[model samples]
Target: MEFVMPVFAGIVVIFGLVKRVPVFDIFLKGAKEGMLLLYNIAPTIMGLVFAVDLLRSSGAINVICNFVEPAADFLGFPKEIVPMVLLRPVSGSGSTALLTSLYQDCGPDSFAGQVASVLAGSSETTFYAVAMYFGSIKVKKIRHTLVAALIADFTAAVMSIITVRFFT
Candidate 1:
């Protein structure tokens, strides 16, 4: 695996040389463009991160969790995963941390662990993705993208619970 990258890179360099392409100049141009794109998207990344943090530190998640506890319980989901359900779409790292905490608190073989695992695999950071993608393209008219992404995220959670129940 370690040798594969170097070998592939060497082959690419050889191929570029044979094609008379200015490999070094092309590489530098690509690097500069990548840096520029990163700069362009930095604000979007910061904004999303700040929003997710605010949702966490402001106790909004807790309030929302309390509100949803009854529905979650009736749906056969646990009381502990309310925060994850809310956060996964907004922030992947936050949800991953929550899932890790669930694993530690309930052990990996436990019901919560299995459900958390499924949720982690099934869902995505919808807001983060949308922010980055749309922000990169400067798309002001999001239309129904947010609604669709959130719906998919909700479906993932429901499916995770149902699937876990069936197998576990």
Candidate 2:
């Protein structure tokens, strides 16, 4: 009975004679348009992805990570947080991959692994999201957006680790 409402509505739409064309045609056309949109946006997405790749491969990430290590340590962060910090800015997937490695190294049920998982889940990929969305819409003014998003990500990362550590 719960699902019957949708089936009944679909039947009426397909069998009704006023429109004459099958309703499936409408869905097909919408799907085709969505595919076209993806194609148009692929270039911008690729550019963001490649820029992240270069950051990961260039050794610059390690240099930046070192500069922040002292402060991160003062905050009680594990040494591994450096790469997580760097990767979070450039690529979401790459960061997740590093997070996975951390989980494997520390064991999934260990404190560090659990904290990393929480941080990974809670934080946003601030730069990548802004770049992809702005480039897709051709918006040029991104002055404060990235800064705000990064602040939110930082808050989430810190709180995630704290909450996970305290609760479990």
Candidate 3:
């Protein structure tokens, strides 16, 4: 398996030589373009990382979870998974930490842990994806993308709970 990539690369180089293609020049051009794209998107990625750290360190996620707990309970969602649900859309690492905590506090066989596991698998890091993709292309106006992504995340959370409950 480790040799597959080297073999494939050798074949590509051989084929390019046969076709008289400038493989080295093309490789250099692609590498330069990738670096340029990274340069263009670096600021947005940094801002997102900073904001996620601020929210986590400032206890904003806990505050939001507290505020949402009642509504979540009323809607039949597991209140214990509130932090994971809230953080899942914005930061994958944050939600993963929250999920690990849930597993430790509630046990993996518990309802909350099961729901968190399902939610983690089913949902996307919507804000991170949108920021990275749009930032790479320099699209300043996202229109309804944020709203649509949030709605999808919410649906995934709800369905995760429902699916877990249905099976268990």
After aligning candidate 2 to the native by TM-score, how far in Å is the CA of 109 from where it should be? 2.0
Clashing pairs in 3: none
Residues 1-168 of candidate 3: C-alpha lDDT, one tens digit per residue: 999999999999899999998999998999999999899889998999999999999998889889999999899988889888888988998889899999999999899989999989988899999999999988999999999988999889889988998998
The segments of candidate 3 whose C-alpha lies over 4 angstroms from its true place after superposition are: 1-25
Q: lDDT, candidate 3, residue 73?
A: 89
Q: What CA RMSD would you report for each candidate? A: 2.8, 5.2, 3.3
Best by TM-score: 1
Q: Report the alpha-carbon TM-score of model 3 versus the true structure.
A: 0.83
Lowest lDDT block of 10, candidate 2: 14-23
- Backbone clash pairs for candidate 1 read none
Instruction: Write one digit per residue (lDDT tens) for candidate 2, span 1-168.
Output: 799999987887767546686677776887899898787678888888888778778987888889999988898887776688668867888888988898888887887787788877787787777877787778889889987888888887788778987999
Let me know the TM-score candidate 2 reaches against the reference structure. 0.81
Ranked by lDDT, top first: 3, 1, 2
Comparing 2 and 3 on TM-score, the stronger one: 3
Cα lDDT for residue 152, candidate 2: 88
How accurate locally, in lDDT, is each candidate?
0.90, 0.81, 0.91
Task: For candidate 1, write residues 1-168 as lDDT tens digits.
Answer: 889999998999999999999999998998999999999899999999998899999999899999999999998888778889988989888898998898889988888888888988888889889999999989989999999999998899889888988988
In model 2, how large is the Cα lDDT of residue 56? 76
